[model samples]
Target: MINLQGVSLHRGERDLLDSADCRIFPGHKVGIIGANGCGKSTLFKLLLGQLETDAGRVDLPSTWRISHMAQEVEASEQSALDYVLDGDSELRLLQKQLAEAEASSNTDGHKLAELHERMASIDGYSGPARAAQLLDGLGFSHAEQQRPVRSFSGGWRIRLNLGRALMCPADLMLLDEPTNHLDLDATLWLEQWLQRFPGTLLIISHDRDFLDAVVDGIVSFEQQKLVLYSGNYSAFERARAERLAQQQIQFEKQQAERAHMEDFVRRFRAKASKAKQAQSRLKALDRMALIAPAHVDSPFHFTLPSSDKTSNPLIDLREADIGYTDRVVVKDVQLGIQPGRRIGLLGPNGAGKSSLIKTLAGTLAPLSGERQCGEHLAIGYFAQHQLEALDSNGSPLLHLQRLSPDASEQSLRDFLGGYGFIGDRVFEIVGGFSGGEKARLALALLAWQKPNLLLLDEPTNHLDLEMRHALTLALAEFPGAVILVSHDRHLLANTADEFILVADGRAEPYSGDLDDYKQWLLGFNRDKKRKEEKSSTVSGSEEKAPEDKKTQRRAAAALREQLKPLTNKLKNIERQMAAAEKALAAVQEKLADEALYSGGQQEEIARLNRQQSEQQELMEELEMDWLEISETLEDIRSE
Candidate 1:
């Protein structure tokens, strides 16, 4: 178990934590959540003993092994698999000793045998294979795993870092935004992997769905204190909402009482008969503690401005091959984007989701296709690269001013404020901004142009929960067409009306939601693995004849027959889950209305709350069924 007692941490003048206390038990999975710069990472560092607390104590077992994902990796020629394997220091040490003993001029047989036994005890011989699996689950291909670590891009390197962290054996694991660099498929894979981990896990993440799926508890940074909740992110949200609602009620009542006292003092201060009463009222008012109003509002609040110009189909592509000059990534794609369309591109990494989006945004031209655009079509394309394109020397005000030269400075400042750039922040140079700030600035610029169509590629990469929620709300209200490629499931679920699967060198409609897409990915990956295994086996033994076609067909038919009932049940569960989610989303949409919280809507709010709980429970039950059937299906497929 891990415990922090009266822990107070200070960064510069900011008191990140003051007398914060929390305890995490063995084999517990907890999520650390808060706004950006809320000391989530700082707390992890404290656990790792990299930083000493300014006050109080942090306690843990002295012998417990801890593993944490590194934020950055130095460029090196180490193979990705080797880098991951290096995470197991003990295994590497044992292997080194064994090699040295064997290579000695006068070999010590007993020492060599002892080293080998120790290695075997740790299953070090299979380290390479295990590392490869981690890499594979993180979106690295077989050939790519053998490539030098220095050869991969920044994001891939981060995945390699995550793989390394998973490779390590530990009693406690600390993962900070483990899914930030992963695609949806990889995120799903990691979710399943983390679910099976037996050790105590503390993850700091903004992805609510991932947190809900993996973590059983939540440790939130509220004010300057660490408050631990008993359930997942959804539970935490509901709990916080209720707490804030109560706080609001108390504040209103206190204000009314204070106002009554002040009025009494004002009306009777000069009357001789009531002079003593007035003085007492004034004293009572002074002694009364102020109840601060609950601030449940998000710092971010903005809408994606849409153009007034009309366009039926914002963009159209026919027989499009989207990729680079030498190779086509997604071939023969037929896609048409109409006004008010909300489409999410889903697939494995390097499966041409970004390529397709780029082509649609007209940033990447199709090799062979007819790309049509509406005459008044204004495309607002946002990508990670755009964040880099921002002028480092320019301020948020300057950036917006360049976009709208004739617009008033006050108007631009107000616009920037919606993106959390207020007052002096709008004039601050962009060079010193953090990644999340840069991403927000880029988005603010995108929203300012009033585009008829928005193409966003991983726009929420560095955003926090508040910013993500704000963006989701903005996208939900935007009237123009949107083509989004995001790993954030909450954003996709709430904003996207349809999904397009880009995989196997083709782009097509995926007739299911994210949950169904996850199921498809599992089967897709299993089949791919089987194909690879078959290809390897056939190549290794050319002399052996292949299996008879009739026998192969019979075996395949038998497997399908065995899987039929389970597959059908899984599909039924998925459909029900989707329906439950839709209902929950509807209730949530109603709950999001500010008017519901204003006043005099207690009955309506209660009804919505009950409905939300029911839908959530139903969704949870269906998910459990889906998981059980999925596991059974996987077992059959493996056999």
Candidate 2:
């Protein structure tokens, strides 16, 4: 448990947090939220003793354990499991001593006994089992457990660090955007694990769904203070809205009072009969200082630039193999994205979602595939590190001018203002901008292009929940073909017409409906977990028993084995249904866009919808079978 009493923190002449009081209790999960650069990370640092407390105290437990997930990570030469094993520092050391003792028969008798005791203590605690459990939960496949950490990319290394952090014995855990790089299945698994974990938790995430899934409370920083809401993200959002509306009403009442006082003074000031009244009103008006509630102007007006209607057949890929260097992330895929379609690329990290989008954008060359584009499709490609890739020395105005050379002065200023860039900000070099600023700039550039085919890769990064919602709406309204890769499930649900889940060098189309995709992801994960448990088995001799624990265990194992293939069959069915439904949605969005504009090629929506309905019915039947099998297995386990 931790508490902050009258804490004030300042950075570079600006107050990040001011005299804020808060309490974080054990066994309760909380989420910390605010606009970017509003002291979320700074508050974490202050708690961790990594920052200075200029004014007050950050009270913590007399003896406590805390682990904060780091944004940056460092590890090399070790495998993923090896690095994560470092989480239990004492256990790692103890294990080393034990290994040395076991290797030698002759040793200092007294020292050997001590080392044996320590090793026995660690083994009894099942420390290694705990480490392996955490690693598996965080999505490290068994095959990659012994692979060197140097083989993984930076994002994967971050996951390793996260696992290490989680493996520690902590009363409180602090996580910042832990789900940012995780896939749907992995995020869901983490949410389940954290929900069942007994500890105090504080997480900072921009994801609405993830916040809702994991937190029991929300603490927000506004006006240099912390405001508490005793509920998850959705509940807090509703409460915050109500509180704002109440404040708005109070503000209006005060404004009216001040207006009345000013009017009375103006009317009575010139009349001797009303001189006393005039003076009284003047004093009242002077004393009446209106309270302006703390607020922010959600900037960035993102509307797709006016684009001409697209012709049919937006893009067609034949035998596509997309990747960088000599490795192919995805290969031998035949797919087509039609005009006005809004499709989302879904997959685990390193599963080629980004690569597929880049290939579609023509930014990356396919190793062997033939890609054909429609006659009038102009692509607006938004890279993951769009703003970071900009020329840092170039001012905002210069960047805008280079990106949109035909824009008039007034138009340029208006566009910049929409993204919260005022006069001076527009002239500031890209190097000086913050993460949020960079993201806004990339969006602005994309909107200015008015491309008929928009390729967006993780555009939701660095954006707040509201901004993400707004972007979803804008993309939904876009009169063009959109192919996006995003970790935000809500955005994918609202904007994408279909889901293309890439994995293991192949693509499986799923119903673009976000909820549908989630259910499928869950089933898939459950199946994989069942398989792992089944594989961790031992051969047993046939033995008759009247009734015993071993007999029950054998029955449970048998039930588990019977359920595996059935569950796997269900996953395959769900995959088919998901793909059909997604393609239907894509057809609908495309048709709607075509109707608004002109000359778009694509499959007919009616036919697609009919096919999707058939797939849905078949999938429902398979799900029923799966449910029966799972329930029967549970019954066996319970018995």
Candidate 3:
């Protein structure tokens, strides 16, 4: 619930938000879309009250709570849990006082009662219990949670801040390109979380799909004014296009009318009776506060320079053993790609995805195995850690000019604009860029290079959903063999023709599509859950699971139904056993808590624990049986 009335803002010689009026409502998922240096971030400062407005006023409730994540964040040497717990300092302080009050059982009954009530009112103060829940939800394990925040990377720190942002309940949340540092799964989790978040949201992101899924309205920054539409990005685009067309026509008509009115006044000022009419028309004309109609332009549209369609194979990796120093990460790999095969390297973090890409780019020598590329096969590589790769001494434009000396001025601008680096952004030092900006710069250079083969490693790292799609389309159309390591599901699905999954020390021909990859990933996580639920050593054992699990039991049951005709009936029996064991686990957790343990409950707890141990073994046996049956079915079904 805020409003900007006649906001006028300027940056240097350019007018950014000129006499703009905008409204942000409660419970509205609003996304701000604009080109770089079009004053998107500048508008944010105005809303943040960091800058003074020369004209107009921003109206918001005095008691409204707000959070801002600065571009350059400094993280202290605090533990992950400690950092997130500090989000609501008031609540944490209240919790501390509540603990003190509880520990000291005083004779002052009235103060004790008040303390208990105040403690209950505080949020996220379950101490370890609440901290563990938040850490787990953010995909951090117990080990990661215990580790100090300094051990984490910059991206993870941003995530830590994001977790803090979500922990505090606010009326409106301002996110400036939140998706920049997050991976695909993290992005999906956040998308789902924000969709369910109960507040008015204002997000500035280049991700079209994320915006489409989340926002209820699109606020466009054009013609130095704020144009608001009542729907998501797609709706806004269609409406904006129509509105622009209408405005152009209206502008032309109004100009003609104004000219006619002026001409009549000029011609008839000397006439007696017509002089009054001319003066009246002149007064009306001067009062007309016409808007300078905005000429609509497409944001990102660029085509690669068509090079000779050479017959040379773009890249080849035969029996490649790619790794760092003595550690062999990926071995026994064979790949041959020519100019046109768009390949996507799919795998999790620390899967040697980057190493493989680097080895192919000839930046690193393989530990062992033959590798060769065809004649005239030029490679353009875009590294994920672009900040390190950039020439720290050079200006932003100078870096690109050094690589592509012959590139025209417009060529650079057009390419830079696609990645949201327009105008003076190109003049700033490369080091001044945010993580997202640096990533986008690498992308812009990749376009300028115009190489025959492209090796993009995690190119979607800081890209919004829209920019990712734009890249996908560009790569798909380019007459080049693209071997990219990306975690963005949509980009991989759209841009890549062949999928190479680099994991477990191999890169094999993955037959399944992106949908199939997603399905396989889901099954993998489900199986992981099942393993995590296992509590003891069996005849043959595997990974350890959590102490308590409900979803794991469900998947186990589904596996049993698939083996309905089995004579062993091991599947169905184990499925039921897992359910019983889970209920047993709940009782054990209750016993651990020591909360409201009524008399004569000891025997029941022991019985449940015994059943849990027994069920663990049964499930292991059934899992082995299911594995055998599954292999057998695959063999039979192939024929």
Candidate 4:
């Protein structure tokens, strides 16, 4: 069990939690939820012992092993499988000691035997198979597992980190936004895995369906308190709404009673006969505080306005080939997106969901075939990349103003407020905003256009639960057609009317729901693996390679020897790059200090500036060297 007693936590001046108390029982799956920057991640840090509580105690079993997903990935050339295996630190340490024990002739035979016993006890021999299973489940193929971790994109690296976390043996696990980087399929797989985990699980996620499926209870951040609610996210929402409603009723009653008492006092306090009574009443009033109604305020609430125009078919694709100029991903796609149609795209990552959406949105023209659209087809396309395209220096109001120049400032502010940029926030520059803020602004920009057709790809990537709930409601009420490509199963299940599967170089309608699709995906992967294994078996049976094996070994040795220097250089540069980045980040943190801008800090400011400049230069130089070495290593491996 984990218990927090009267916990008070503060981030600078803002008190995240004040005298909050909560207890999580053993093997309980608790979903942590709140608005972004409401200290959900900070709670996880406190549990991980990375942050100390300001005032109160957190009690957990001292011997319980805790595991957590890493937020950052170091640039390393370690294979994905090896990196995941490293999560079992004890196993790795045992293996290392065992290797040394075997290498030393003077080592005690009993010590060597004891190491082997420990390895067997820990299932160390099956470590590789376990890691491979985790990798495959997390959407990595056999080839990709053998590939170095540095080769993956940021999202893929996040998946790798999740896989590593899952690979660790733990009594308690802390996962913060595990589904953020995942596609719908992988997210489903992870949900199933967590459901079967025999440990206490605490997850902070915005995906409601994920929490609904995986958690038995919820821990919500509200009114500077960690309130534990029984049941899943949906249950918590309904219960909270009901509770708040009841609270409002009681508060109103209390306010009326207090008003009556105050009015009586004001009218009679001037009389000498009632003066003593009025003084006593005033003392009683001083001891009482006005009951505040349960405040449930969500910073996000915006709807995608429907275009005034109408068309039966918003978009049509005939024999289309979707992809870039150099490659075609999905071919022979015949589809029509009609008005009021809500179609969700489902496929493996790297498959052609985004490509197909791009083609439909006209962001990428088809390499072959034709795309026909209605005369009034106006698309409000939202993609992950579109967030970056936002003008960082511009405020939310400015972005909206660029959309509708003739609109009044008050009208724009009203519109932006629904998307969570209320009051002075609407005028603040977006450069300092968080990713979730940018995503909301991007969506806000998309909403203001009043497009008839919405093509959204991973639209909820950075949105918090409240924002996601707001988006879900908005999308549900949207009058126009929507083609969504998202990893958020809850969003898809709630908004989409049907599923379109894009795979195997083609796009077609899938005659199944999300659950059915998940099952199909598992079967599809199994069939593919089986076929590959059969083909390998057949090819092996036909090979007469007794002598060729010796030649292959010799060539492998020669390649390894040739790549040794480049590998060493790559590791060295990676270390230097990491160091430079750490130093740069430290300087940047200091630069963020408000004191640096105050009077008499010119010398300190100049020193930090010089340090920042030097670190940046060093990082750039190391990065170039790292890239050159990586490319040379790739060339050697290709040879």
Best by lDDT: 1
Backbone clashes counted, model 1 = 0
Lowest-sum lDDT 10-residue window in model 2: 287-296
- In candidate 1 the C-alpha lDDT for residue 411 amounts to 94
After superposing candidate 3, which stretches have Cα over 4 Å from the reference?
99-117, 121-139, 245-296, 299-301, 306-312, 319-322, 325-331, 364-368, 395-401, 404-441, 460-473, 487-490, 503-506, 511-639
Residue pairs with backbone overlap in model 3: 207-465, 208-466, 532-545, 532-546
Better of 3 and 4 by TM-score: 4
Query: Model 2 over residues 1-639: C-alpha lDDT tens digits?
Result: 678888888899889778988887878889898877888988888878898798889988867788888877665787777788788777787777767877888767798778767767656357767777777777777777788888887667777878888887677888877876666666776876677668889998888778866787789987999887766665465345435535667446534644654454454345323333223323332322111111222444456764676757878889988887879889887888777676778766567888888888888889997999888777888987676677889877787899768878778888778777788778888887777778878888778877888899888777865566557646755778888887776666556555677876898776445655666666665566667767767748587556788987997788879778767876776776677667656643543342422222223433443454444445545555656566556645554
Candidate 3, after superposition: displacement of residue 326 in Å?
7.4
The clash count of every prediction, one per candidate, is 0, 12, 4, 0
Listed in order, each prediction's TM-score against the native is 0.82, 0.73, 0.68, 0.76
Question: Which candidate model has the greater TM-score, 2 or 3?
Answer: 2
Best by TM-score: 1
lDDT of each residue in 292-315, candidate 4, tens digit only: 111235566577899999787888
lDDT per model vs. reference: 0.82, 0.70, 0.65, 0.80
Estimate, for each residue in 142-246, the C-alpha lDDT of model 3 and write its tens digit: 568777888888777777777776766677788887777665545655665787678888888877656765787778887899988666654454344335544
TM-score, predicted candidate 2 vs. hidden true structure: 0.73
